[model samples]
Target: MTPTQATAARRSKISPERAQELYAAVLDELREHGYEALTMEGVAARACCGKSTLYRQWRTKPQLVAAALRAHRRGTLAAVDTGTLAGDLREAARIAAGTSGRDTRLTQALGLAVLSDEELQAALREALVEPELAAFGAMVQRAADRGEIAAGHPALEFLPAQLMGVLRIRPVLEGRYADAAYMERFVDASVLPALGLAPAP
Candidate 1:
């Protein structure tokens, strides 16, 4: 089909609930079979929808997977407000630790494929990375406003990387997922100290 026709096909509305179902099916397929092995036909079969429907909606595997990742986004960090930067960072750490295993596995599954596929890389950033970065920025801004941390503290720039890096790296370095306790300790030991703050009592 022509580009215009493809764009029109993509504009066809699917219910929010149905879209979520399809997205879940796509994630499940990705988890069970890494990106290289995932197929539009498999997603169609798993979602119990017609293959043509998948094609009409997303046009290709990269588009479909991107949509799925976007739809699956949960703004977990955006909700954190513990009244202090240290408390907020600890809460964020706890939350990240809670899902570290599942998320790490998903990241690993999509690792090389996402690096090569611009569409997937952009989707991952939009769906996962950017949201968290925004949330952390908000948290840091709030802390600065409250005078809990200096506005120009260098560590502020690295907060997201510090938290996300630990979550992604623990499994690689220790062969164990970063748990809530470990994450909380990390915030106390590494993150807070870097900002010249101490863990909240």
Candidate 2:
């Protein structure tokens, strides 16, 4: 057989489990080294696979990182039906706080880079921001239907921003991670009051 044929034969097709392993390795590397320092080689090494494996799965670093984030994305708010916006917000906050500190660190690590890199920006938004916004929007609609909040409340438009802002900044301001209790408190103290709703029972 020709050398080209031999090389092609040696390239194993990546399986779902193997791909998940690589995605996790990429997140681990990002947590350890930050996005700016992450490399295909580092992820490959961490995943115990060849660089060609990653390159074959994702053509570029941005794509690889994005894919990794998407792979690990949570569906915390997908089925959130607390019957009230306040309750939903509190529940959402609780779920978000369950995320590991590593995920939070990886997010902060990618902040500046997302500003300058369009692809990275889109990936970050798609993997992180968009899903949360979509689910929150759904919760708001449900609240409107239940008469807990007005459909046209101005604060309705900013709920995602408010929650995301607190989650992102708490570590900087408090020198501590935003845990479930903190999130629930923020929802009760800030989120509900802003929307003219009472705190959850």
Q: What is the per-residue lDDT of model 2 for residues 1-201, given as tens digits with 9 covering 90 to 100?
A: 953244234434677788789889998888878889999999988988888877765667887887788678565788788787778888888878777355678788786898899988876676567877889889988888888778999988888888778877888888888888899998888888889989989
Local distance difference test, candidate 1? 0.84
List candidate 2 segments past 4 Å from native: 1-13, 73-75
Indicate the residue-level lDDT of 181 in model 2.
89
Give the root-mean-square deviation of each candidate in angstroms.
3.9, 6.4
How many clashes show up per model? 0, 0
Determine which window of 10 residues in candidate 2 has minimal summed lDDT: 3-12
- Span of 10 residues, lowest total lDDT, candidate 1: 3-12
Clashing pairs in 2: none
Candidate 1 per-residue C-alpha lDDT over 1-201 given as tens digits, one digit per residue, 9 for 90 to 100: 965366446745787788889989999999999999999999999999999988888777877776777556444899999998888988998888878887788778886998898877765675577888999989989988998878889878888888899988988999999999999989888888889998878
Clash count (model 2, backbone only): 0
lDDT of 2: 0.80
